[model samples]
Target: MSKNGSHFKVLFRPKAETFRGGCGECQTSCQSACKTSCTVGNQSCER
Candidate 1:
């Protein structure tokens, strides 16, 4: 039997999935909508 708490267990997870790459009109619209562009492609080359 395991004694791990639910709250603690909830925090553990596998690698987060990357955003779907869509460099179309929809993506452009979303970028414009956001106050600060947070997407990786727009900001830097590393990731």
Candidate 2:
């Protein structure tokens, strides 16, 4: 996370394939919100 905590980044990919919904709302709901929002928002993710 940045010093100010306004923005952060993390590297992760869900092990289950049932949560590939369009929006990343599932990630945050599962307590797995990606810091960069790349998994769901940008749809460019790598585990």
Candidate 3:
């Protein structure tokens, strides 16, 4: 269980970094729409 948890954390670390970096820009460009899409798992801005 611990091993799986560690692997999952590692797998998502880059995504977290990308989100931190891109989220600001997304918010600047799209405002509330970006936040809504992100929370809803749309990931349209991730492209």
Candidate 4:
């Protein structure tokens, strides 16, 4: 499979939400910034 496909699998598979949610404390601003960057199509937050 391609790199994109692998990413899709990991992103959409069950239990993925565990990794998606921010750490709440340390991730508050950082997650927001990452989400904003992603919304603009930057996609730098994929990792």
Candidate 5:
């Protein structure tokens, strides 16, 4: 989280598998699935 309340660290907590959000552990109704590693705080992230 940043100074303001509009920022958050996008933690791509991969499940038992090696993928990020393709496994069943991902949010059941994830609307923002399979996106880049960037977050509100991270404008850019490595591939």
Candidate 6:
């Protein structure tokens, strides 16, 4: 994750870097990833 992306994780899903909900609840980068898969954990990033 980038410097700012990490911050978003802290503010949003601090426990996990993967998708916790939908685009609205994820970070900007995560929002994009959620459409496919999260690069961080390579998990299903969809809602």
Model 2 lDDT, residue 16, Cα: 68
lDDT of 6 by residue, 1-47 (tens): 66666633444545453335455644355556557765546444343
Clashing pairs in 5: none
Can you give the TM-score per candidate against the true fold? 0.17, 0.16, 0.21, 0.19, 0.17, 0.20
Candidate 5 deviant stretches above 4 angstroms: 2-10, 19-47
Please report, in order, the local distance difference test score of every candidate based on alpha carbons: 0.44, 0.48, 0.50, 0.49, 0.42, 0.51
Write model 2 residue lDDT over 1-47, tens digit each, in one string.
66778575656767665365345433343224455444555453332
Query: lDDT, candidate 4, residue 12?
Result: 57
Model 1: per-residue lDDT, tens digit, 1-47? 23864444455654544344433434244455356656534542222
Sorted on lDDT, best first, the list reads 6, 3, 4, 2, 1, 5
Model 4 CA deviation exceeding 4 Å by range = 1-27, 38-47
Off by over 4 Å in 1: 1-7, 12-26, 35-47
* All candidates: CA RMSD (Å): 8.2, 14.0, 6.7, 8.7, 12.7, 11.8
Worst 10 residues of 4 by lDDT: 38-47
- Worst 10 contiguous positions by lDDT, candidate 3: 22-31
lDDT (Cα, tens digit) per residue for candidate 5, span 1-47: 66676576766865654443243453333234336333433232222
Candidate 5: Cα lDDT at 43:
31
Q: Candidate 2 — what's its lDDT?
A: 0.48
Task: Please identify which of the two predictions, 4 or 5, would achieve the higher lDDT against the true structure.
Answer: 4
Best by lDDT: 6
**Clash pairs (backbone) in predicted model 4:** none
- In candidate 3, how many Å is residue 32 off? 14
